[model samples]
Target: MTTFADLNLHERLTRALGELEITTPTPVQASAIPEALAGHDLRVVARTGSGKTAAFMLPMLHQLLQHSRPRTDTRALILLPTRELAQQTLKQVEALGRYTFIKAELVTGGEDFKVQAAKMRKNPEILIGTPGRLIEHLEAGNLRLQDLEMLVLDESDRMLDMGFSDDVLRLAAECRAERQTLLFSATSGGNAMEKMVASTLREPKSLMLDSVRDLNESVVQQVITADDVKHKERLVQWLLANETYDKAVVFTNTREQADRMGGVLVASNLKVFVLHGEKDQKDRKLAMDRLKAGAVKVLVATDVAARGIHVDGLDLVINFDMPRSGDEYVHRIGRTGRVGGAGTAISLIAAHEWNLMAGIQRYLRQNFEYRLIEALKGNFLGPKNLKSNGKAAGSKKKKMKKKEDAKKGKKPARKKPVAKKNSRTNKPAVPDTNSGFATVKKRKNPGSID
Candidate 1:
C-alpha cells in the first residue's frame, strides 16, 4: 500500500502528482523507486502503460532536486527509441519538474538542428531525445555529457530493433564512466539484449514485473476470422458500429493499410484519424490531440505509433491487421487495458494469416478466443488443420520434409576425371605442370615411348 507520498520524493514532485491526481505508485515505481533513489543503476522489464516512465523520472528528478548544482551541463540524459516517445517522456519530466527550478527539454528528429542546438545551449538539467538526433547534436558539438550523472535507455529492445545499438552504446561510452545507467525494456531475455545490458549497465538492480502472458491477463483478447481484405473492412465497420467503447484504436501493419482503414471508417460516418511514421510531426501531433480531445473515436496507426501513443479512456483496440510478433501484439493491446482498466482487443485474422496469429499465440502461451458475429460470419471458419497441441497447422515443417526427401532421392553430382597424356603421344596433348608445353620432347623416333 505504499503511495507516491511514501517514496520520499521531492516536495514539488509530490505537489505536481497531487495536481495530476496520481496518488498511488504503480508496482514498478513501488519496486524500483527506492533503489533508484539510492543511487543504484537499474534494469527494469515491464509492460507499456505500467507507469515505468514515472518510476525512473521521479527518482531521477528527486536526485536532481536533492543535489542542486549550477547548471553547467546536462545532468540526466534519457534516450528513447522514437521521437514520439522522447517527446512524451519530455512532457512527463516537465510536468513533474513544474514547481522546481529544474529545466527539462526535448531534442527529436523532424525539427531544425539550429533550434535544437540553441535549446541545448540553455544547458537543461534533463535532456530527453531520440538516439539518431542526439548523435547528430553530439557530433555537431552542441551537447556534452561529461557532467552527466544519470543515463537512461528507455525501450532498449525497440531501440535495438530500430538499429540504434551502435549509437546508443557510443553515447554511453562518451558519458562519464561512473554515471548511473538505467535500461528499461519490455522484452526480458535475448542474446543481443543481454550483451547490450552487460555493456550499458553495471551490477544493476533488476526488476521484471510481468511476462507477456501475465500482462495480457487483464485484457480480453479475441479474434475474428475474415475471408479477405473486404471481409476485414466489413468486420471493422461492424465492430465499430456495434461495439461499446469510449475510444478505440485500430492497428495496421503498414501505412497504406492505416490510410485505407481510416478512409473506410470515415466513409461509414465514424470519426477517424491516421497516424504513422510517414506523417509529418505536425500531423502526427494533431492526430494525437484530436484522439485525446474525443474529436475522433477511431485512430488508425501502424506499429511505429504503438509504444509511444498513450490515450486515456481507450477501452477497445482493434487489430485491423494482426501484428507480426507477440511483443507487438502485447503492446498494441496494452494501449487500452492500462492501470487496471477493462479493455477489449479484437483482431481481424484473414485465412492466410492464421498461422502467423497462431505463432504469436504460441509465443505468448495463450490462445485467442474465436468469436464470430452471426450476421457477418465469413467463409473462413478457422484453420482447417491444427497441430497436435491445437495450434493452427502450417506447411513449413512439411515443406522442409519434402525438400529433404527430394535431396535424398536425387543422384549425386558427377566429378570430372583428370586426363593424362599417352606416353606414345597418340592422344591429344596435356600440359605438364613444370613444362609449358606437353613436354613430349619429340622423341628421337616419332612414335617412341619415353
Candidate 2:
C-alpha cells in the first residue's frame, strides 16, 4: 500500500507525478529516489524502462527547485551514454518539472553548438548531455560546472561501454569535489566503470535489482549458421517472410549495414526504419518515432539504435550481427520483452562470429538455445563462378581475391576456415560465397580456353 507520497517526495512533485498517472513507484524509483534525495552518492543497477530516470530526476528536480531559480549558468549536470538517451531523459525531466520553474538544456553532437552556446547564456539550472558533447562545451568554456552540486550518471556502465571514460573524467574535474554523484546502469560489473565511479562518487550506496530484464523465456534464443554474408541476408528474408511476427527490430553492427538492410527489407515489401549515427537528428528521430507510431514495423539499426530505444509491443529482435560485448547483448535484447512482454531474439551467427557469440553466452551465463529455422534456411553466397570483382574475406575484396588469384600464379586461400563443431551440428552443410556477390548467375565464358 506504498506510493510516491509515502516515499517523502514533495507534494508538488508528487502531484506532478500523479498528473502523469504515476501513482506507484517502480522498485528502482522507490529505492533510488529517497536515497538520491538525501544527496547520498549512490550506485543503482536496474534494467531499462524501470523508471530509473525519475528515481534520479525527481530528486534533481526537487533540489533544483529548492536551491535556486533557473539561471544563465549551469548548476546540476546529468551525463548519459547516448544522445537518444540524453534526449529521452530530458523529455522525462521536462514532463515532470512542467509545473516547477526550471530551465534544462541538452548538449549532444549532430546539433548546432552555436545555438547551444546561445542557450548557455540563459544559465540553465540543469544541463543533460552525452559525455563527448558535454566535454566539448566544458573545454570551450561554454559549459561551466563550477556551481554544479548534483550530478547523475545515468547508464554509467554504458558510458564506459561506449568508451566515454575520458570524457566523464574531464566533466567530473569541472564539477566541485563535494558535489553529489549518482550512478545508474543496467550492468555494474565493469572494473573500468568502477574506477571512474571511485573518483567521482562520494561514499556511494549501491542498490542492485534482483532481475535483469530479458526477452520472455518462451521466446528462445536461436543462432543460425551463416557461412557467408549473403546467406545471412537470405536467412533474414526467409525468416521475415515466414514468421508471423507482429513487429521486429533488426540490429546490425554498423550504419552502412543498417542502410543496406533497410533497402533489403523495403524490397521485401516490409515497412522498415533505419536508425544510425550517419543519419541527421531529424531523420533518426523520424525513424524511431515512426516505428513507435506503428508506421514502420521492421526497424533496421546499429548499436546506436539499440540503447535506450523504448518501443512498446516489439515482437522480435534480430541480431543480423551481434555487438562485441556481453553488455551490448544485454541492452540489445533488453529492447524486447520489456515491461513483462514476451519477445524473441535471433542471431545470425557466421563462422567469424563464433568467438563473439561464445563470449556473449558466457556473459549472460546462458548459451543461446540453438535452433535451426528450418523453413528460413539458405546456403551461403560466395564467389563460385567467374568474376573480376570478387570481394576478399581476409585481405582485400573477396570477389577480387577469388578472381585475380584464379588468373595468375598466386595461390588461393582455403575455401572454408576450419573450426571444431559442437552440439547442434546436425544441420545441412551451410554454403559459403566463394568468389563474390556480383555474379550469382551462371557466367558465359570469355573463351580463352585453359
Candidate 3:
C-alpha cells in the first residue's frame, strides 16, 4: 500500500503521477527513491518494465526542483544505450515533469547534429542521450557537464554490451566530481559491469530488487523444438497466425535473420516490420511508431529493441532464433509481461540451438514449458539423451575407455615415432636431415687426423 506520496516525492511529481493514474510505487521505486533522495549514489538491479525510469527520474527531478538555480549549463545527464530508449525516456520525463518548470532535452543519433548543437546552446537543465552521440557533442565543444548535479546511467549493462564503456566513463568524467550517479541494469553484466561500477560509482547503495534468473515471472515461458531454420520459419508463421496477443515481438540473433524473417512473414500477409542496427533511424522510428499505434501487430527485430523499446499491450514475445545468453533472453522476453501484467513468451528452438536454449534455462534456474503444435510439428523432439543439468549429453566413449583401462590395469598406449625425411631426396631414411641442417663430423685426434 506504499504510495509515491509516502516516499516524499515532490508535490508536482506526485500530482503528475496522479494525473497519469500511477498511484502506488513499485518495489524498485519504493526502495530506490528514498536512498537517491538522501544524496546517495545507487547501483540498482531491477528487471525491465519495473518502473525503473520513474525510480531514478523522480529522485533526480525532486532534487533538481528543490535546488533550483538559474544556470545555462545542463544540471542532470541521463545516458542510455540506444536512440529509441533515449526518445522513450524523453517522453517519460515530459510526462512526469509536466507541472514543473524544469526543462529537459534529448541528444541522440539519427537527428541533425547541428540541430542538437543548437538545442545544447539553449542550456536545457536536464540532458538525455546515448553515449556515442553525447561524446561527439562533448568533443565538438557543443555540450558541457562541468556544473552538472546528477548523472543517471540507465541500462548501463546494455551500454557496456554495445561497447560504450569508454565513452560513458569519459562523459561521467566531464561531470562534477560530487554529482550523484544512479546506475541501473536488468542483469549482473559480469566482469565488465563490475569494472564499470568500480570506475564510475563512489560509495554507493546497491538495490537488487530482482535477480536476472527470476525476472519476468508473470510471463509464461515455453519452447517449441524445430528441425532447422525452415522449420522455425513455419513455427513462427503458425504462432503469429494462431497465438492470442495484442502485440508480439519476434526476436532474431542477427540483422540478416530479422530481414529475412520480416520478408517471410510479410509474404504470408502478416503485418510485420523489421528493426535492427542496420536499419536507418527513420525506419526504426517508423517501425516502433506503427507497433505502438497498432498499425502492426508483430515486429521482427534484433537485440537492439530488447532493452529500450516499451509498448503497452505487448503480451507476446517469440524468439524466432534463440538468444545467445541468459541475460539477452531475459531482455527479449521482457518486452512482454511488463510491471505486473501477464503475458507469454515462446522460443522456437532448432537442432543447432537446442543446447543454447538449455544453457539459458540452466542459467535462469527455471525450466521452460515444452510445447508442440500438432498441425506443423517437426522432427526435432529434443535430444534423446540429456544430462542432469538439462544440456544435451556429450559422447561418453572416451570416459568408458578410461574406465575399461583402469579395470584391466593397462598402461596407456604411447604415440608412434614420426618418420624423418632426407633433405635431397625427401624420402625417409635411417640418417635423416636434422630439420634441413647438415650433420657435423668430429675427429678423435685433431692433430693426427687428415
Tens-digit per-residue lDDT, 128-213, candidate 2: 89988877877787988777888888888777867898889888988988889988888765689779878888888989873443
lDDT head-to-head 1 vs 2, winner: 1
Error of 1 at 136 (Å): 0.8
lDDT, model 3 = 0.91
Which residue runs does candidate 3 get wrong by more than 4 Å? 396-450
Off by over 4 Å in 1: 393-450
Give the TM-score (vs. native) of candidate 1. Answer: 0.87
lDDT of each: 0.87, 0.78, 0.91
Candidate number that wins on lDDT, 1 or 3: 3
> How are the candidates ranked when ordered by lDDT, highest leading?
3, 1, 2
Model 2: lDDT of residue 114: 93
lDDT of 3 by residue, 328-443 (tens): 99998998988989999999988879889889989999899999999988888989999987878977797699889989999778899987775866845656669878778775
Candidate 2 vs candidate 3: which has greater TM-score?
A: 3
lDDT of 1 by residue, 1-450 (tens): 478878878889999999999998989889888989898999999887888899899999998989988847999999998777887788888888889988888888888899989988989999999989999999999989999999999989888888898999999998998999989988874887888889988898889887766674678899998999888999989999999999999999999999998999889988899999899888888888888899988899999888888778899999988898888888889899887888999999987788888888888888788898998987898877889666576678877877887888964456989767666767676656866654545546567577
TM-score of each: 0.87, 0.78, 0.87
